[model samples]
Target chain A: MIFLKFLLYVWMVLVLLGAFFYAPLAKGLGEYTRVMYFHVPMAWITTLTFLIGAIYSILYLRKKDIRYDYYSETANQLGLLFALLATITGSIWAKMSWGAFWNWDPRETSIFILLLIYAAYFALRSAIEQQDRKAALSAVYDILAFVTVPFFIFIVPRIYSSLHPDPLINTQGKVTMNGKMQLVFFNSLLAFTMVYFWMLKNKLEVIKLKMKLKQLES
Target chain B: MIKAYYIFRKDLLQEFKTRFAMNAILLFAVVTLSAVSFAIGTFTARQEVLSALLWIILFFSSMSGLSHIFVKEEEAKTADTLKLVASASAIFLGKFLFNIVLLFLLEIIVVPLFIALMNFNVQNYLLLFFTLFIGSFGLAGGGTMVAAIISKSGAKGALFTVLSFPILLPVLVSGISATKIASQEQGWMTAYSELQTLFAFSVVIITASILLFDFVWNE
Candidate 1:
């Protein structure tokens, strides 16, 4: 426990330091660049959480495990929260750069749709009273919906030109960032991933406890 | 295959016996089109405007048809019985085909009334027909799956649109685009890719929903 706390503190410190330098570092590029440090990391974290949720969903379907279902739910809830943050940050950045809060650009539209799909996921879960059915149906939808994520996020957007910038971090490594920018970006990514795991662990524990209490009552 | 056909026939027969579903859909379509026509003054006066107006009518009218898809089953408590005997795939196919038929009938009435009321000439009748057909298939296919999920929620009508519209964005985009292009009598190649995209979307969504239906319905 002590070691975990130490690690979390270290992670938080790194995140704060990265954020502190974001403006000065992004200044070398342009005024609008500050958004990338926060927006990109948040978007990455959200997508990572969504992927985790999709995996848990598949596991729940295969094993019929309630714990997996809870884990999936927790990830989905957190994913939605972060996705909203990503959208807001991106929108703010867009307004600064393009003088528009909303545009029908493919990326913007796709992310909005992605958010709505997950919203409907929760809605579908709530409408069903039976716990097992809710788990099963949500699992199926999650898997199916995730399959479309690539199409919406990648394929469709690339098909049409858009104002949104491509990723600085590519498969091969940093795209064109200088050494300093790379260091800060990498640190931010690591810190955010740690934060995501920490939150997920706590959220799953709470979910387990709630389910236990519910079971006891019945 | 034969069993699937039997299920389809059974649904149609049952619907006809009561005439409730068909009557509700047809009346709603006619009344809504008439109201819109009256509001627009005359159809021919604004050809481009009429084209868009026609799609809006079809979209909203389809919503009413989709909302009650499973309401009667739940009320009558026949859903469980149906589930026990009929394959999930069969049920989905039957319901999907039924929706297509109902939507087709509604469109037949609505489309003509739209042209006549709006006084818009369909330059390429065949292209217009094709776009409408493909667009309807995409809508019905997607709407049927969502309706099944929503039906289990016990929240019908407007709730259906709330749950469905997001998933239906791509369909809406392609539908409107195709309608616009076809109304202008654009060449098939010009809109062919968009049409194919819509068709592919229908296939993918239907297949995914069918595979996932057992998980949803059994629960």
Candidate 2:
């Protein structure tokens, strides 16, 4: 585990260096396009964590095991954290590119909706006092919230003409990035995904330790 | 299905006698509509703005009362008794139907009042009707399930709207867009995508709710 952590630390440093130095300037975006290396992967991680959260929620419901509930809750909280980071980073990028902090771009609107959905998840969790009920209700909510994600992320954006740049894989199903930039972008994505799993693993371990401590105290 | 029908009829009969949800929904719609029309008097807002405003009112009004479908049961301690009598899926369907009927009755009043007061003109009434019809199904589908989840919580009143808004946004987004097209005198083809989205959203939410209701209901 220590070796894995060391390797990830080195990997992320390399990815960061690649983002700043190795990636070439794009046609119009110039230096601002480098934001893609961080922002896009964060958004990607946000989606990944939420999907994982929903899957664990299903597992929790099926098995009625508290461990899956802990996993689901941890995943959702991380998802929310990453989503906020993505929104903040995207907003900063928007101010640079679109001359305004927010244009209500379809992407912005969808992310805002996503933020609200998960915020409501926490609200629901807080309102329920019983532990089992909180776990069950929140698990159900996590699944329901995820069901709407495809519509928000894919369909709603398609409905509106977006001011955001074309997705890395555009509608015609092509990778717009050149060879070198593609390498850095994929590397950044891989690095960030690794970071997400590391964070998840650490968070789960912390939760497990907390539960064990509580049992000892009781 | 027959068990579901009985549950629906029971809720409808109780609703007719008390008119609690109906009155809350209707009053909220009327007040919001009047405030909006008064605020924008002679403003002649664009069709898009008017269409969006109409949905905003419907969305808030639905939020005002939809949760009562389940909250009332929990408050009265009837939820457990109902669970014993009818299966979870049946209970979900019955409440879902109740909410749908209430929303339809709400539109019957609010839609006309909204158009008259806001000077909203819809050249394609059929498209407008279809949008609201399908949109209400989506609203009720998502709203009923959320209502079930929230009713079990301690903070039912405030949590209902907070929980339902995001889930209901897809319906609102498509509803507003389709209403805009209908008001602009566009044909059915122009609004087809939005209609399809509303239909799909309703189907997906209801199916998921049915599958998941057992967990919420039994526990």
Candidate 3:
């Protein structure tokens, strides 16, 4: 954990330097393209956490284990946080590039619905009082929400052209990356993923400790 | 399969007697459609706006009562008997079929009234009919499973809508787009892709729900 923290800090400084100094400013975005470093990673982390949560949910249903339930619910909460940040940062980026805070662009709509999905997940969880029933219902919901992710993020935006060009990818499926830009983008991706793991580890520990405390009290 | 039919028939009989889902949905539809006509009265709305408005009414009206398929069973304490007597998939089919019927009845009433009230023109009657037909099927399919999932929860009504909005957006988007094409007198080929999306949406959700229903329904 300590190593992971140190690595994250080092990667953070590198990302700051790489984004401003090392990465080349493109034609259209100029300085605003730097926001891609933060926004893109947040989006990636958001999708990744959601996938993790759904996988754990599926495992929970199959195994009938409460451990997997904890994993699923925690990951979902984390995914919601990441998705919120992604939306806000993406909104800032959109304001810079497209002259609006929220254009309901495909990506914006994508994140919005994603937020709704996770929000609904929590709502369903809260509404159910029984332990087993809550786990089972949330597991089913997690799987269903994950199923819609591809349709929202990939298919919907491509259908409409109101999407101003994405930073790393164009609508045409071509990678528009130069050498330096590619390096920084990939590094940010790696750094955010490590940060995700470190946070997941801490969250799992916290939940585990809480359960222990409840058991002792009982 | 026969057991599922029996379940569906049972629901039909009860609903025929009570008409709870049907009455609620149709009444909601009438009131909302009236309000919409009043709001947009005497103004020429775009084909897309009109199409979206029509769908908005249908969507909310459907939501108002779609959970009856499962909720009624739980409400009256029949869900336990259902668990013992019928297979999980049978229950899903029974609920799914009931929802489709309710939606069908709703459109049959609202469509004519909407066209009459709002001066909503449709150049392609067949395409408009097809869009409503398939869109509601998709709605019923997803809504049935979702209805089942939420039936066991305490806050049935609120959870149902919140959970359903994300899953059903693709259907609404494509449905609205297809209706727009049909309403604007665009070529049938123009709405073809949206129709394809709707078809795919229906197929995928129905299959997934059916496959997943046992896991959800069985406890």
Candidate 4:
């Protein structure tokens, strides 16, 4: 675990260096585009964690395992934290690129909706008292929320483009990029994804220890 | 399927006998309409604004009563008895059907009063009706599912709206756009895309709720 922690830090440092020094300035947006390195990855981790939560939710429902339920709840909690960060960072990027902090861009709206969905998840959790009942309900809710992510990601963007001019989307829904930039982007993405797993692992362990302690005391 | 109707019939019977859900839905609808009319008072509202307000009224009005469908069963302690008698899908369908009927009835009374009071003109009545019709199904599907999830939770009032908003947004977007087309009297093709989107959303939510209902209902 210590080795893994060391490796994650090393990876993160490499990504930072690559993002600032190695990655060439993207066209048009110049300095503003650098935000993409963090913004996109943060958004990715947000979606990934919620999806991870939903998968664990499904497993918990099927297996009736308290551990899986804990993982699901933890994943959603982390997902909400990452989603909020992404939204703030994204707003900053929007301010720089679009000359406004909030424009109701499809991407912005998608993240906002995602934030609400998970916020509701937390609210649902708090409102239920029974252990197994709360877990069951939240797990089902998690899966239901996950089902909408695809609609937001794909359909929302299409609605925007068809209804209005898309400032950010490139032709054919693909942004043309050379291999080097792709490498740096993917590198940062991988580094952040690793960071997510490490945090989640640590969170789970801490909670597990707390549960054991509670059991011993009781 | 037959069992589903039995649940539906049962809910309809109960709703009619007490007029409980109906009265709550209409009172809220009328109150909201009155407030909106007062707020927008004499402003020459745009068609989009008019379309949006109509849905806002419908949305909240539905929320007033729809959240109670399952909560009623749980509160009345009939959930367990119903659980024994009906399959999960039957209960889901029954509740969903009842919600749809409630929304339809709400629209019937509210939409006319909404247009008359707000002086909102509908150029394509057919399209407006279709949008509301499809939107109702989408709302019922998602709302009933959420009501079930939060039935035993403490904060039904807030959780239902908070949880419903995000999922309902896509529906509202399509509904607003479609309503705009209807108000503007745009050609059928103009509203087709939004119609398609609304239809797609309804299908996805209902199918998902059906498949997932067993776990939520049984647990």
Best by TM-score: 2
Model 2 residue runs over 4 Å out of place are none
Q: Rank the candidates by lDDT, best first.
A: 2, 3, 4, 1
Q: Is 1 or 2 the stronger prediction by lDDT?
A: 2
After best superposition, candidate 2 residue A182: deviation in angstroms?
Answer: 1.4
TM-score, prediction 1: 0.87
What would the per-residue lDDT of candidate 1 be over residues A115-171, giving only the tens digit for each residue? 998998888787777888778867877876776676567655654567787755444
TM values, all candidates: 0.87, 0.98, 0.96, 0.94
**lDDT of candidate model 3 versus the reference:** 0.87
Model 3, docking class: medium
Backbone collision count in every prediction?
A: 5, 0, 0, 0
Please give, for residues B180-207, the per-residue lDDT of candidate 1 as tens digits.
6777774777667667767777777778
What is the alpha-carbon interface RMSD for each candidate? 2.2, 0.6, 1.0, 1.1
- CAPRI-style grade of the A/B interface in model 2: high
Assess each prediction's global lDDT (C-alpha) against the native: 0.78, 0.92, 0.87, 0.86
Cα lDDT of model 2 by residue, B61-114, tens digit? 999999999999989999888988988999999999999999999999999999
Worst 10 residues of 3 chain B by lDDT: B150-159
Which stretch of 10 consecutive residues in model 3 chain A shows the poorest summed lDDT?
A162-171
Reference-based lDDT, residue B51, model 4: 94
